[model samples]
Target: MIEFATHRNKDPRLSFRVLDMTVKNEENLKRVFTDTELNPGFDKVFSFACLMWTSDHEQCLENIFKLLRSGGQTLVWFMGYNDLSIVYKEILEMKKWMAYLKDEPILKYAYHDSMDVKSDCYNLMKKIGFQDIISDCERKHFKDYVDIYDFKVHECMDPYVNKLPQHLQREYLDDVITVIDRHIKNDGLTFDLIILLASKP
Candidate 1:
């Protein structure tokens, strides 16, 4: 939650500090960074770190290197774009997809852009100056992961079949209604989520 001040530039309390998140919460990001009394060097920053989709990995690593005592550990987590289409296709089968689509328009646009950015998580991390890239597929071997569904149908199917033609959109969507019916019963599955863990070593 970011509180906006109309005259933030003149605020005396405004300052910056680097922080690491050990837990999943990020509502306090602006607060942690803007505290005047904080210093990444003096504070025992998070030993376990997490990187989110919005975090700049380079800045995170740089802060860890500069502020953390040597041998201090930071864990960064980020989302990967590889096979994002297929993964989203699977997620559409889940109940959460509808609620998400109602609020997110850029997600579909980003999905379109991802087609050409073939650098999977590992490759992109390496390009950004990370080392010790490790791609882990172990989660696929376990059942704890959420089941996936063919969500791409929602993204591309409309343009694929409609293309400004209203009749065509309805025709395609109606046919999908049948497939969706069976899917709701757990009969549909799609996509692979590859988890890659990279390090600074």
Candidate 2:
């Protein structure tokens, strides 16, 4: 994602740095910044699909706070729970596959639970001393069946599909693709995407 962004913006003033380390390590985080004070040295921090992997969401927010200059902002985007009316049929189809792959650990890791902190994002930012906190939930409705089918397969199934037996991987992927294709044609899927924008005080 960063690579794509940097490639599109070639101006030297627009610098992009990719850190290969986790935010849990404060020491490693400090190495990325020149300043050692409470406020490190960035005007803005953007987190996309990263918080879900972090073990400590609040700590991660704190670390980001430490890196931002006073009044700097952080923008976060993450997935939230699906709208039952729109996703119920799709969920039923997914459950069938999940039951068949119940023994797979990756399946459990990928689908059994959500790592997203969608419900707590606003409160977490407030607790971390962010001001002017604003959060919005947008329901995305896909007009094209292929678009949503592709999204579900890639975002929700790919991780688990990679862990299937070599011979079964293709079969599993094909099965999911078929299921999504069928279900989506009947009723287009809708899901909520949450965005949080907050400023460090």
Candidate 3:
């Protein structure tokens, strides 16, 4: 966490303020930089969020570019595209079951997939002039590559559910309950995916 204030800034005496920053310095910073997401901000940008959503990554890189000086550095954490696609394809098949879960709040769209969540993130960071872009997809890094929350079905359970019209939400809640017993005959745990880093280039 290298912090330097120029002559015109609020803390203008050139005194470095490391207060409230993570790690001791950049070298120590490497100890904690792992799977995360980025959010754009005006000052120094540090993210510990997941990279499952590409739009968030794009916005985070844009924020890092805007917040830092020309030589300033940022470390972004996220998953690679390959690991996510496997889970995505399975989730893609869920598109066929809309009639059973469409009225369920979380699955209102039933077909909205924010594809290219990784390639798009990396591209956005590069366009923002991040040069040390290193993608480390060599590990099981992401925690939730595919959202499988239920009461009805998986995917789009967060904002999608909250975004639905209240009256239309309950229209399909219990409908899928009866269908779920027949849906998972094997009765087992399924694997999603895990991707590593996609940083600036």
Candidate 4:
């Protein structure tokens, strides 16, 4: 994705730098772009399908605000809710998997289960000092069969599978397939995709 973005850049004045939002520390965050040619403060920022992986939304947004120059805008896209997360949450509660996944508390689909996700996100952004924040959640319906194989290799499932013994890994994946099969409604899944557009003061 980074390579594609860089290749499509036709303007010499605009440059792209990568920040590891997963990193929570100031030093590690600085280390990523310390030697880059771009000066401090970006005019725009973007995050695609990335915020769900972050454990700290406040810190993440704060970092983005800090990276941007005054009046800089940002667009963030991420999953809102889906049956896949329900399947994963069920798997987390399974007796056999509990011991292996005891340390895992935060779900990748973190705020999706909330009763009012938009308001929650809006409040967070407001607290972070972003202006003109818009948090929109769109519910999308799918008609295709659930790809059991693809999700088994997904990052959301990998953490749980990685913690299990190699012998139990395949079985766990099979169990996930079983649970997913139970939740599939007419061979399709509904999803909520959140689009957040905001700007720094």
lDDT of each: 0.39, 0.61, 0.38, 0.76
Judge candidate 3 at residue 9 and give its lDDT. 56
Could you tell me which residue pairs clash in candidate 4? none
**lDDT at residue 49 of model 2 (Cα atoms):** 59
How does model 3 score by TM-score? Answer: 0.35
Superposed model 3: Cα runs more than 4 Å off: 1-43, 54-60, 79-124, 138-159, 166-201
The C-alpha local distance difference test score for the whole of candidate 3 amounts to 0.38
Which structure is stronger by TM-score: 1 or 2? 2
lDDT of 2: 0.61
Q: Pick the candidate with the highest lDDT.
A: 4
Displacement of the residue 107 alpha carbon in candidate 2, Å: 7.6
The numbered model that scores best in TM-score is: 4
Q: Which stretches of candidate 2 lie over 4 Å from their true place?
A: 1-9, 20-22, 36-40, 49-56, 83-119, 148-176, 182-185
| Model 4 spans with C-alpha error above 4 angstroms | 1-24, 35-39, 106-108, 145-172, 185-187
Off by over 4 Å in 1: 1-30, 33-103, 106-119, 137-184
- Over 51-126, each residue of candidate 3 has an lDDT whose tens digit, in order, gives 3343334454554464455445565554333332333233324554354335543321111243543454455656
Show how many residue pairs clash in every candidate, following the order shown. Answer: 8, 0, 3, 0
TM-score of 1: 0.33
Q: On residues 1-201, what C-alpha lDDT tens digit does candidate 4 reach at each position?
A: 467777898588755667777556767656765534225577888988777656677888888887787788999987778767777788899888888887787465757668998998899899989999999888887765456466544534344677788889889888877787788746687778888899988
